[model samples]
Target: MTIRDRTAIVGVGTSRFSKAPTDTPMRLAAQAFKSALADGGVGRDEVDGLVINIGWPLGVDYDRFAEALGLRIRFADQSWTHGRFVGPTLQHAAMAVATGLARCVACVCGVSFIQERGLLGGPGDFEGTREEGGTHEENPVYGLTAPAAGAALSAQRYFALYGATSAELGAVPIAFRKHAALNPAAIMRSPLTLEDHQASRFVVEPLHLFDCCLVSDGAAVVLVTSAERARDGARTPVFIAGMQGMRAGPDEFLFATPGLGIGQQREFRYTPTEEQLSVYRMAGVTQKDVDALYTYDAFSPLVWFVLERFGFCGLGEAAAWTQKGRIELHGELPMNTSGGLLSEAHVSGWNSIAEIVRQLRGECGERQVRGARVMQWATAWGDSTIFHS
Candidate 1:
């Protein structure tokens, strides 16, 4: 009954990431789709299923994409428009392929943040932030607002509780920027220093401008199919070894670890139990087995929280754990080696998924993790999928 290793991500593709809008979502998606088909040695006619994470006008819609790509899709789905839905969208594709509802499923995301700034969370938008409305994270009537405010609140509390500092937080983006330097497609590849991070202006006091992810335009495609059929693919197959769904409730926050006191999250000493972190149990692996890690790094603080949430390190230890090149390539736990959302363009975290596929295939030359047999895609929001080559 277990779905573990039942499906494999056979191919992945992505468009050039840019800070400025060059092509429409459909145009970029078309390019990435063709690339993915070629990479997987798959034909357009073979794709009978489709799943989308971010939809129009922020990205391409499912119905329009099928018609434009000329795909006769038998199964199709689209998650709500948000960065957090990337993991769920991928898991759905794997489930569809494993249960025989479809032979192959193409998981798609083509977003243009540069084009749709006012649609979602941003500075001074028209649809005044409110509880469970206007992006669901904002409640401006009570001075609780989207994104930056929530992250900053958690970071402040974490710092107060654990003695962490913004300078220590610099290590995350700095590590990712180092990785971005090796990637030709990364938007911000320049050398980043702790001093640079410390000096950067604060977007939401206690959270520097560098702490946020880039607002960019791009598309990425990942093809999912059963493991039996994946063995016949052109490139190596990266098996989806395990999965855990997103968590929610009074104790959970979309941007903070459980019990961080953000939004309605309750405050408590949150040291995750083995039962709380089922991804490791489902994957048949431990944190020690992970050669690399990837996450939706929308904010640098989220990186710290994800590490603690996943039991990679004890609560309040990520700030210290991430130091001294521990997360860089060839380090103890290389992460986001393709630069991630901090330095790499944010295609709603799909860019990092494509990076994971490339890493497992040994295709990434300079930034490749050595002996990367196991890697994971997880997020601070608490969804995860473990993949192995």
Candidate 2:
């Protein structure tokens, strides 16, 4: 279905992003959902559809949540395919509202410390799974079973190909930390220096501890409604201008796993592909038209890789581009104005999306982009969405 301007994100809200959140997942989600409703000037009875995303060890039924909220919805779903379901969930809610299957839909997602710590036991505990083989089955031999191992390998290969230095890679975290300093909601608000990023211990060689995202506990909820309904809402509605989702391709896997040094090895990216060009075409916007950018940054290199895939710069040039300060606020294009996943909270990309809404609505005080008209959000896993006020 054509998702261009059919629905609007009328309200956005987020719970505290922290390492030690005391509320249960359900309670946290409810708090954010209610805040979204209030922001939209919507009532609980007005909601006709519900969507929820939860991580491992904290699975909550959508139906039960609807019942608890006293919402009799026409449709409800739990989106938990992988950890990267935020983009897809938003797309699903937009389609529902556009097609009249639901008048108003709430997309809620959150994770708790219990899940991150693996306090509640599952099939195999978090640490025990490391000994087992990973998806490739040959991962254990290379000691590449853990995610950081793959990231480290990718960074090494990327640096070798582009002659990018670790200090150049440090620029990513530095810019994010600068933006985070302006955001009161960000967990890592302390001033950060490139020297500090380089001095931090390496989780995997070339990937420092500062390069990784935090294990945050929080919930974020967004309310989507038809354009007509949103026009009358309390807050200025941010339209869902366009969306595109894609996955890894043969070239991507080859680059990630260059056996015998033979594959499409030139390019290095967090995901195998970027399907954002089509989204921009559908929305009738261009890279230059975007007033602000939010790229998913679970790791620092992700910003560089995705910038290359999205045609923001040539492959291997992202390091130099970042060093030039194009990503900081008041630059050519401000990025992660809310600190992103690296310094901000990592509720997947939910908080990033919220920042976009706030920016478009002129709600962001110190970090606000003046007269921001269009904002684009890209996930590390080949999902992209654009929003405009």
Candidate 3:
């Protein structure tokens, strides 16, 4: 009756990361879904289950998406997952298939974060009611104006605490761009070096332009079904070994409001360490079993936080660990083989999961982690998953 080993991700599809404005969100969703269907050898009519995310400005509800895709799904759910809540929607789709609520399920998302799409706005715009002067009083007084600035504050603390140098911090994006150079689907495949990363302008203090993820326009979809059914698909199935979602309280490090004493300090719970350990226990595996790592790298400092939280390194040791080339493609633990959100595309966390499925199926040609049997995808907020072939 457990969700473990009950269902498999049979197919994955993704549109090329671009800024040329090719299609609407619905059309993008349909394109990715069709590609996934072709990959799985499943027809559109066979899909009776669906899971969709309704991120602000990327609004494609379940019913409308179903209509657009010409699907009549019996089990459909909509979500608005951000940060650590990425994997819940996918897990719901898997559960539906496991319980026989539907046979084949399509999990899809279409995102366009470009200015021309009319989705642009200042920070916290998605939260609504951001009137000019009325909301200013309660706003934190510290420089937590945006995610990048918040990350900068965190990064400054990390550097001061860990004695990490700017060169060490610059290595993360350098490695990501190296990986992106090998991925044709990646948007920023141009060469990037440590020197280049260092020379880039600071979006915020201690965080450079290269350290941030691309603002992308693309769609990605994955098809899930019973393991037995997946055995008959066009490609190998990547089984969902385990998944867990974790969150922090408002008083926690990452959630602390600016202008408050707690927020001004260097204490942020960027990683849910205990919850991550619990997920490992639930999966009955340890970090030693993982063949590759896919972390949500919206900011490069996030990679450092992930490494330490996931037990790859001890507290304040991620910078030194990266300096040793421990996370490169040929290093001890290869990370972000598909370039992640940093270089591949930022469709929330969907692109990262798609890369995980591909690696497990042994579909990645050059950037492949050889003998990649089991892999982990972790988000900055705490959503984590383990997949295997």
Candidate 4:
């Protein structure tokens, strides 16, 4: 019944990242799907399971992807369009293979953030309304709205409580921009300096434009199959060593860790205990064993929240922790070595998952985490999966 190391990610593929709507989501997804099949040396007929987190407007649904990609999937699942679903959806793919629901599962996400598609704004906009938003985030009741409000709310609170300034927050994107400069597929590769971050106009008060993720078009796919099948395949396998489900409730904030007091979340001193972050226990390792860390960096504050949520550092210590070269390549704990959602194209965080698989396989050319054996995909909202080479 153990899921650990039973299902391995053997193939990873991604389409070009762009801010322009040069192609459709289905077309982009098809490109990535074929690349993944070829990367794993597996045939299109071998994929029988499909799971997608982003649907419609921002990306394609499971049925559209399966039908358009000519995949005959016996198992399929799709969820609301949000970055929070990335970790859960990937876990579902591994569970499918482990439970024999499908032999090989393709975790797919094709995203186009271009407004020209007419998928965003005007009643078609999916951003939470005052009904759902008032409870979870700060959103306007009129005009076009986005998820940035929630991130901005979280960042403002972190700055006030910990005395961390926006200048300190700039470090997260500054570091990722450095990584993006090395990645050919990244859309925001221009060198970003702290001065540039400070000078950028505010998207929402404390959150400058650079603090938020890019609105880009791209697709990424990761192929999951049993460890036994991977052993017989053409590429090296990156085992899913451990997993912890996404957390929710009155105390959990989508953009902040527990007890940070955003929305309905209660205000208190939050600490990440061993029993709370069981991914490490399930993987039979500790925080010190992780060679690299990757997260859903839709905003700079999320990087700080994820560090505290995962116990990489104490609560409120992330502002100081992320400074220096700590989170950069070859640092104490390299994070988002592929620029993540902040600098890399925002493909609903699937790009970072693809990066994790590449790091474990030693496939990343310049942005690789040297000798990386164990890499983790975690989020500020509290979902995680640990992988090992």
Q: How do the predictions measure up, each by TM-score?
A: 0.97, 0.89, 0.89, 0.96
Candidate 3 residue 356 C-alpha distance from true site, Å: 1.2
lDDT of 2 at 366: 88
Backbone clashes in model 1, listed as residue pairs: none
* lDDT tens readout by residue for model 2, 89-128: 8888988998889999988875774455443223333432
Writing each residue's lDDT as its tens digit, candidate 1 over 1-389 gives 78889999888889989999899999999889888999999989999999998997789999999999999999999987788999999999999998889999999988898898766555555454443644545556656455676778788889998999998999999999999999998999999999999999998878898999998999999999999889999999999998999987888877788877877777887888877778889889998999999998988998999999999998889999999999998789998998999998999999999999999999999998988899998888789999999
How high is the lDDT of residue 45 in model 2? 89
Q: How much does candidate 1 score in TM-score?
A: 0.97
Candidate 2 clashing pairs, residues 3+ apart or interchain: none
Error of 4 at 330 (Å): 2.0
| Model 3 poorest ten-residue lDDT run | 132-141
Residue pairs that clash (backbone atoms under 3 angstroms), model 3: 84-381, 84-382, 253-268, 253-269, 254-269
Query: Model 3 RMSD to the real structure?
Result: 3.7
lDDT of candidate model 1 versus the reference: 0.89
**Candidate 2, lDDT over the whole model:** 0.76
- Give residue 164's lDDT in candidate 4 (0 to 100): 94
Top lDDT: which candidate number? Answer: 1
lDDT of 3 by residue, 1-389 (tens): 35677899989888767866777777787788889998889998999999887444564678888887789899988775343345777888888998999999898888776633332324444432344211211223443344566566668767776688778988888888778888889988899888888898988778899998887788899899999999989998999888776545444344222112234334443443465566677667888999988887888988887777667777777888887667878888888988878888887778888888988877788888888898988654456778889
